[model samples]
Target chain A: MLLLSACGAREVVVQGNFPKPLMDPLPLTLGVIYTDEFAQHEIFDEAAGRAESDWLVKTGDAQVEFWNTLLNGMFQEVVQIKDSQTLEAYKNTVDAVIIPAVADLQYTIPLHTNIKIYEIWMKYRFKMVSLEDVHGNENGDLSIKPDQYFADWTLTAYGKTPTAFLQSDEEAVNLAAVVALRDAGANFATSFSRVPDIAAWMAEGLQPPPAEATDIQRLEND
Target chain B: MIRVIQGKLIAGLVLAMSILQGCVNATVDEMTFLEPTEGIGDASVVIIGRRHAPDYETEFDFIECIGDHIRRGDNSISVLHELDFINMMYPWFEPRTAPLRTDDIEKLLSQERVANRFEELKLEYMIWIDGSTIETNSSGSMTCGVGPGGAGCFGFGTWGNAADYEATIWDFTDEIEVGRISANTSGQSYMPAVVVPIPIIAPVQGTACDSLGDQLLKYLSAKM
Candidate 1:
């Protein structure tokens, strides 16, 4: 007889603690995005689509909420530097036409992980644009390009020797993703530093200095 | 007395070899479904759905079950067809009404006609699979080495439209089924495998495909 588990057999678990997202990029400005043939393909499957259009009237609303959460988790941090002015000015500068040209993060390559070993991988892409054009600046040239962005994650800890299992393999993997996400953010900061609005906005929204801590304890501690 | 003891020992050895031998042990566990259901939209059209398949090794135990079932005078094909979608032919082939129909004459899942080698063998029934446990283990780009477990590089993965598409296609509640699944696996490559510990409950009312070539072969093959 094939042995079945009464409670259901668990083949794998969260072997690694996924890194907690540092923070939400604030003063959020949604990117309108660029168009590409393959990259712009529909994101929904047949069954999911049918459940909305034909069967349920409110399906579209639920569907919209779902992707929003995914997109929300993608961009976790926006640190501000004192060099940037007010949040509104930073937001306007960040929303300037060029922001949409880059893909918003769908997922980040967590730190210290070799993406190759993963059974599941995630990635995203976008149409790049320039800020000078958003406000229709005289210097705007309407530069355009497809920016394909990718990050990798690995899920291992299966079939390792019993001795290997004795260690906390799962935590190791989770920590790796956290570090990797930070690395990817740093990468974005390095590349987009040229865009003053992007640089200024990113500084203000991504990471607040210890002095600017919003925690309730900070006020009491001081 | 010694000779009798030797006979008993030989019988036990034969039984052990038959019962104990089985497939390899490789388990995949875990699935991360990324997303927000919100913006997940329906595509304008669907040309085809894609799913991967498991390989022979991990499913070796099922094959052994087939072997035992056959040894027990079971004329049944005893197939562990591709997961979730089992379709086999014996009496006559009721292939799908599609451009890419399976011609018994062809030994392939593609076009161009030719007889399959197994034409002589009795094919009782095949399990049309919708779900599967197979995955490719090789890494690197598929061009060089193995692709994703879900991708077909090492042929180690299992994901077939058999589960979703076929489940709807072969509406079990309204349609007829011969037997209920006894034991199995379900879920992602890692956590997906499920086992129904109890004996399979045969369907109360079901339709058994009657075929001349396949049923006859099933009979003859079992005898052998």
Candidate 2:
């Protein structure tokens, strides 16, 4: 009975924890914005080199919220803005803005007589530019060009029985996509020092030391 | 009444001995598959057994026979043993059990020295064979020892052997799977010794090699 019971059952879950920043967090506030096409679900075709409308994923806001929370926990400060247009409003408040897009999202489910395999792949592209650069107010004609970064992730799972196979396949595909996006978000939080111009600007913008309180009598004597 | 009971006891003893007797024969089961590889002709391929087998060292001759069959089937395909390839490309490795990432392959290809070396060799594919043939079941045993006169064995024995192997093909240029062929051969054998001796052996490894080699040949052949 035990052997027969075990033949039809298996479970696997893969999730990566965000790593600590290698260097101290940059003393810079940042804004994040998603593209207008972000919410629209797209099927990326490798042969065609284009994306078409497919299954809709209504969790864009939730995903943005997750990144906002994760970045805030990792960095000095991060604010999730509505879109690119809204990024201009935070020019003076935040030091830089990041535009992220889901460039590719797809999965393949291979069927077998007694087993099933599901593989999910995702690619995310991020563009980062300082607020001053976006407003065309460069510091002494030295413009900071936007930096681009890409993260591609693939995840797979296997199932044995028909019912369990379908359920696990769906779960694996969805979880893989979500985890890939979140991982890219976490990576973005700790990658400021990689860009030379941003690193230099951050170094110059370090916060001032706090003033210590002094006793009233000592102050008067001084 | 005493005579009848003695007759019945002898009959029961003979039945038990007959039930426990061993004989010499073999049985086998096999499975094979082939997929089309459209343009993989004349590619350089090396076959090797994994270093870390469960109990026994992998029989290299079995794989050599497979390589021979593949060469005979396709004259254009270049085949080499793993040791020769390892000697040539001493520093680098083609990992087994996991797919190599394209980015990593690209990095190796991007280096000027490695790229030049790779251009010289133009090695593009690999076949990793892993698994073992083992004795699954055995019953009854024959014992023999040398005395002043000679050796002798007193009993009978039988055993079942199983050979399971999986061969994975990799395309280095694309960093993807060309195909996978798995072959399993299982059989049983027996040995009996009374005055003279008789032994039967199951060639599980040979059967696996032949079956897997044929599958690889058909799989790599271009689609019509």
Per-residue accuracy of model 1 over B23-72 as CA lDDT, tens digit each: 23222222112111231122110011112221111122223333334334
Best by the TM-score measure: 2
- What TM-score would each prediction reach against the true structure? 0.20, 0.39
Model 2 has how many clashing residue pairs? 0
Reference-based TM-score, model 2: 0.39
| Candidate 1 global lDDT | 0.26
Q: Give the alpha carbon lDDT tens digit for every residue of A54-123 in model 1.
A: 1111112222232233234433322221111322244444432212111221221212133322122123
Candidate 2 lDDT by residue in tens digits, A49-105 = 222212332435544555555556546777765533554556579766666566565
Q: Given candidate 1, what's the lDDT at residue A106?
A: 24
